[model samples]
Target: MTPLHLTATALASAVGAGSAATLDALRQERSSLAPCDFEEIAIGGQIGRVRGLEQVELPAGFGEYDCRNNRLAWLALQQDGFIEAVRGAIGRHGAGRIAVVLGTSTSGILSAETAYRARDPATGLLPDWFRYDGSYDLFSLSRFVADRLGVTGPAMTVSTACASSARACLDASHLIASGVVDAAVVGGADSLCGLTLRGFDSLDLISPERCRPFDAARRGISIGEAAGFALLEREPLREGGVALLGIGASTDGYHMSSPQPDGIGAEQAMRRALASATLDAADIHHVNLHGTGTRANDLMEARAVNRLFGSDVPCASTKGWTGHCMGSSGIVEALIASLCIENDLLPACHGLETRDPEIALDLERHNRTARIDRVMSNSFGFGGVNVSLVIGRPAR
Candidate 1:
């Protein structure tokens, strides 16, 4: 399969906006997880809440999409000529020639929750201010983003738990390669909401202390919210950013909520990605692991890494710095991997301390400065959905 080139990528998360701030935090090994102070349902552990969404003014016409999720998407698109890149792709490919594919688990549910809370007692109905019809639909998010960007091509949403955005990347690549579209606006966005917080709380997966991925005493995961966008084209536009070498996806058919104990599915995903990239496991220099800090998840992923890449590849998970941004995790982490290729840096695992005795891998305890040429990012979600994306610097 011909690799689909990624022209540009952008991210907005708790670590900060743009790649510079995110890479800075990664270099410093900073953990941004702090106690959640939101009044609605304050669960302990760090969250990647954007610091100043209140101060950001929306464009005059986009006031209706004012939730934190869309707000962050708007803010991220404003960075480093990202908007221009999308416009350029549109101009080159024509408005109808591009497709839009987004991955999101919680799309506009926060607005629905707000409306549900603001029901008028006198009328027994939602207030007019909160009665917007598209507040709770998942497709609404895709439509909102497509309409906002003037992208008239096929628009679809993928909601396969945490692997959603990663799957979006794979779908976009196929669309562009198959002559379905000339370019694709591929990414995802998710927001914090009371239902998610309480649901995780009910499952007892909310960690009180800061999340410690791969730690010997790792407990559970911390929730987060983010929005990431990447402009992908079939061919390079001038100096292209990085090439999406391959994407591999699988489902374990194991437990609905837990991964296979021996990491069989995860290993298959990584192996498939490497094979699709036409590279050996030894060719990968670094991996952005899906270290959610949960005991089961970390252990399974560690075993998979050991089986596939041995213990030589320096690996780390950025969840400690950005928290687990759920559906957007794949895209956010993919952006980090792209940045690693762009800057020749390997980010440290923010919260890992003592490596688990059961897992054998060269886990980076501190920031490592090296020329990273090839990177793989893993995103595994509930229901055994697993996705692995391999990205590399364009060959000169």
Candidate 2:
């Protein structure tokens, strides 16, 4: 099949609102993670909290359904002419010719948790202030975004843990390539909540200090929240836009919440992505690794990178700057990779001071400029779901 092109992309992560802030943070090796101040959960470490969500007013019709997740997406859509891009796509292709696909793990569950805490003991009904039935459902997020953008074509939500957004990109590319849709808006959004904080704490994966991916003394991961979106089309609508060369996905089905120890599934996913791109492993210039900073996740990804690219491709995990955004991590990192392609620079692993001796891979520990053409982004999720995407510079 002919490859689909990514006409435009935008990101909202802990680093900042758009590509400029993200690139600045990457260049300076600055981390957005800081101690959490929320009292609901006692988990320690840094979190990627968007700064100004509280200031934005929701649309008139969606007053009662507002939540942090939706609010963040709304704020992000306003950046980098992203909303205008989506509107243009719809106008050119017709609203029915565009599709909306979003990936999220928590959705708006945070709003539900808030409402649950305010339940009335007498009537067992939540207060009107906390009433948000539509905000609590996972499907509502996609619906909200679709309705706001007036996209009338296929709309769906993907929830595959960490690989959610990466798989969303895969699905969007497939739909455009198959002519099911002339264009697609693909990305993910997730907001911080007590449920996730405690959930990770219960598993002993919360770090007290900033996360240090690939560091020899790394402890665990720092949870984060983010929203990212991209526009994909069958052909380039503008010159010099990056092309989505190929995407590969696989599931090991090994464990419920842990990855395969041998990294076999991850290696397979990378191999498949290379195959789909019709390029050998040597063709990959950089890798945006799924380095969560947890002991197991980083080790497994290191092994997978070593096996797939033989330590030649420069790889770095941007989680140190953005924290682990969970479901939205894939799209955030994928956008970072896209920026690398556009600017011909490689982002540094912000918190990585020393490399683990056990891992035999070239980890980028400092900001470095390079002429990057082809790059790969890896997203491995719980249940051994793995996704790899290969993106290249626009074809000349």
The prediction achieving the highest lDDT against the true structure is 2
Please give the clash total of every predicted structure, in order.
2, 0
lDDT of 2 by residue, 154-257 (tens): 99899999899999988887787778898889998988888888888888888889899989989989888889988887768777778778888899879977
CA lDDT of every candidate: 0.83, 0.84
Error of 2 at 197 (Å): 1.0
What are the per-residue Cα lDDT tens digits for candidate 1 across 12-120?
8888888888888877777667788654475666676778865776567866666666776777777667777888888898989889899988887787788878888
Question: What TM-scores do the predictions have?
Answer: 0.95, 0.96
Report the error of model 2 at residue 274, Å. 1.2
